[model samples]
Target: MTDAFSSSSETVLQRVLEVSLKSNTPVDKLEELYQIKATCDFILEHQFAKVALQFPDELLGDSVAIAEEINRNTNAKPFILGDTSYGSCCVDEVAAEHVGAECIVHYGSACLSTSKRLPLMYVFERRAVDVDRCASSFRELYPDSRSNVVILYDVSYAHAVKDLVTILSPEYPNLVSSELVVEGERCYSPGFIKRLNNDSLPPEQCDSQVIYQFGRQFSLKSGSSITDYSMFYIGEEGATLRNFMMTWNRCSFCSFSPATMTGRAESISVNRALMKRYYAIERAKDASVVGILVGTLGVADYLTIIQQLKETIRRAGKKSYMFAMGKLNVPKLANFLEIDIYVLIACPENSLLDSNDFYKPVVTPFEMEVACNKQREWSEEYITDFRRLLPGGQSHVPLADQQDESDETDVSLITGVLRSHNLLNGEPAETPSSSSMVLRNQTLTVANTNSAASFLAGRSWRGLEQKLGDTPVVKAVEGRRGIAIAYEEEGTAS
Candidate 1:
C-alpha cells in the first residue's frame, strides 16, 4: 500500500539505487540473495517450531519477495516474521521483498510494537530511538521458550555481543533456548575480548568515559562494532567485518579539514560512500572537537575525518582533539584533527612512540575515563559526585536539562566493559622538544577529567613498558599520562 522510496525520504536511497544499477547489480538482487540464503538456512535449520527474523529498522519493502525467494530456492517453505505496516525505508527491503511466500507472518499491529502473536518474530534492538524494548530483550522466555530465540548480531553489535555473550552465557543457561545467530563475518580476536573482559565490573556496568576534552564521550563498550571494514581484524575468535564507518559524500569537498593532508577524498571515497549509505555517524554539535587516531590506516582514515570536521567546526566551534592507537603517526592525525590533547587506546602496533609516527603527549585509558565522567549527569548513582551536597549522588554532568532524564539509572550494556579498564587516556607533551615536530612551548592536555585516568593507572597498572611490549610510554606517550578521543562525521557529538 505504501509507496517505495518517495522524494522526501528516498533522496539518499534513489542516489544509491542509481549508483548500484550503473555500477553493480540491481538493488533487488540483494533481496534475492537474502531470500536464497534464508530459505536454505531455514530448511536446513527449521526443525524448530518458529523462526525469528532480526534486522535494523531500515528494511521494510518487498517482504513478499524475500519469502517467495526463500520458498522458491528451498525444498520446503518457511514462515517469515515481517509486517509491511512496520516499514523502515532502508535497504533491509533487499531481504524483505524477496522473502516471497505467504508462510511469513508478522500478523499483529502493523508496527513492531503493535505486532501480536503471529508465530514469526521480528527483532529490532535500537536503543532509545525505540522505547518499545521487546525487539531484543532476551531473558527466560519462560515455560514456553522452545521456539529458538535466535539472537542475530550484525557487524556493529556483533563484536560487543561476542564479548557479552561469553560473559553472560554461564548465567543464562535456561535463558538461551535457541542458538545464537551471528552474521556479517566480523571476526574479533581473542586478545581484545580477553582484554576487555579482564577487568572486574558488575553486570549492570556503570563505567562510560570522556572520549576527549571538550565534553566528547563514547561508551567503552558499545553493543555494536559499528565499523565493518574486513581489513580491520580483531584477531582470533574476534568477529571480523569490513570497516564501513566512514562517510564520503561530504569529504570530497572539505578543504579546511586537516585529514585531507593524510587521506585524500579521492582515496577514501569508498569509505565515505559506505558510511553515508549504510552506517555513517557524525557529530551533533557546532563546537570545535578533539579526536584521536590509531593503528595502520586507522590514523590516516580518522585524520581525513577530523580535517573535514574542523572545516565544519570553525563556523560552529566544536573541534576534536586527536590521538592514536599507539604513538604511531600521531602528528599526522593530531594536526589534521587539531587534537589539543592526546591519549593512547593501545600500543599494539607502536603508532605512538615510533619515530616514523608523529609525536604526542602521553595518555592512558583511565585519563580518558575522567574526561567522560565530567559530562555524565550521574542520574542513578547511589552516591553523587557533588561531595555530600546531595549525599547519594555520584554524578556530575555537563548539561542542565539532561540531569534528571539521565538520572533514570539506565546503564547501557557496554557501560560495564568501560568500568573494567580505563577507557580514558591522556598525558602531557612539551611543544616541539628536540626531535619531534617542533612547535612553541605548549603542553598537550587531556580533554576530560571525568574519571581520574592518571589515578586509575596508578591504582591498576604500573609499568606500561613491562606490560605492553614495543609500545612504550613516557618517551612518546608517558605512562598514565592520558588519552583523548573525537566525534563522528555526522556531528553527532556526545
Candidate 2:
C-alpha cells in the first residue's frame, strides 16, 4: 500500500504544483497544463483506434513529427474521411485513426451506426458523399450501436461551426452530446444547442465556467467590456478584463501590445477606417438591420470586449471593425471578424507616459506615435493608390492633441517625442536574427534623481509619484517651458 501510494504521488498529476505565476502568465497555468495534456491524450488514443488521419500535402517543415505520431498510432484498414486537403470531414487517415472507430464517415453516414441519430462529426474538409446505399449492410456485420463522431478543425473555423451547433444540440442532444470533443474541450453540436446566443448553454457554458473559475484560481479576472454606465461601478464577471490578460501582452505603455500583433492591428484599423467610409458614403440605416443582434454587453468576460463592441457596431449597420485590448495570442479573432486595419497604442507615444517594454524594444512609445502620425500623414499625402476606405475625406477623431494641454518638463528630455515605434521598412517580423538584434531600449532616457532625462534600460517605475516627490503635469503653455513640472505637495493635480 505504501509503495503504491508513493509511486502514484510521483507522477505529474500528483505533484503539489505550487506555482506563483506572474501577471503575464495564466494563474491556472499549472492546472491547465495538467488538464490540457490529459484531455489531448484521451482524444488522441480514441482517434488512433479508427480512421487513421494522415498529413496532407500542404503541411510543411517538421510536420514530420505529426505525421510520425499519426503513423505510430493508426492501424491498417482504417477508413478515409476525404481526399481534399481542406474539405469538411477533411481529416487525414492518421488524425482520424485516433478516433474510437475503424470507419470515419461524413455527417450523413455518422447517423446510422448507433441510434435514430449519431455523432455527426463536424470537420472543415469537404468531400463527395457515397450516397448509393445505407451502411446497414456493414452495420449488420459489426453490430455496434455507438456513434462517436469527432469534430476536428482549426480554431480559425469556429464561426463556421458556431451556427451548426445551434441546430445540432436540440436535434440530437443525447446522441451528438455524448460523442463530440473539440480542441481538447467538450464541444456540443449546434443542433444540440438550444440557443445560439445564450451564455448559460452547455459546452460553451462549461467552457466559460471553467475558464472563469480557473482564471480566479490564478488570481486573475478575465477582462470585461467597459461601458459608460459601468465606469467605476461593479460589473459582472464576463464584462471585466483580467489584469493578467492585459499584462500578458505586458506592455509598459498601454494595457495591450501593439505592433507585435498584425491581425489585431488590421482588425482595429479596418473597423475604424470602414466606419469612416460608411459615414462618408452617408449610408442609410435600413430596416433590415432589425434582425441584427448586438454582442451581449457582458461578452468582455469570455472574449475581448473591444472586439465585441466592433461586432455589435457591425450588427447595428456600422462597418466591420475589430476591437482592441487583451493579451490574445491567436489571430483567429482578427481574421474571423474581417478586420483590415489595426491601430496600436502601446509605446512612448502621445502623452508623456512611457512603457519600458512592450517586450520588443525596437517599437518604442515615441516610435508608435510616429508610425500612426505617418499613416495619417501618408493617407493625406498620397490618397491616389489608397482607396478611401472611410467614405468621408478625413475623420475627426478624439486625440491627445487637445489645444489647452502643455508639458512642463524640460524640453531637452523629450527627444524624439514624435518619432514612430515601428521599423523604418515596416517589415512584419520586426527583428533580424540574433545576429542583428540589439536591446535598443537600454539606450533610452528616463527621469532620474535630479529629475533629468537620464538613460535607463529596464521596466518602468509606476506612475512617477513614487520615484519623484513631484510628477510632471500639462501646463497652460503660458511660459513655454516643457517636460518638467514645478514640484508641489502630493495633492497637486496631474
Residue 8 local lDDT, model 2: 16
Candidate 1 residue lDDT tens string, 60-80: 343444444544565354433
lDDT of 2 by residue, 1-494 (tens): 00011111222122243333232324344222112233224345555344322222332222223223333444222322223222221222222323333433232111111111212232222222221111222122223334221121122222333343344344333212111222212222332212122244455333321211101111111232111001010111111122212212211111111112111111123234323333321211211111111111111121232333233333222232223322222342322222222322221111111112222111111122222222222131112101111223233212233243222211212232322222121222223222223222222423111101111222265224564647666577545333346433333466
**What lDDT score belongs to each candidate, Candidate 1 first?**
0.27, 0.24
> What would you estimate as the lDDT of candidate 2?
0.24
Candidate 2's TM-score reads 0.20
- For candidate 2, the 10 contiguous residues with the lowest summed lDDT are 227-236
The list of candidate 1 runs beyond 4 A from truth reads 1-33, 36-236, 239-289, 292-334, 337-369, 372-494
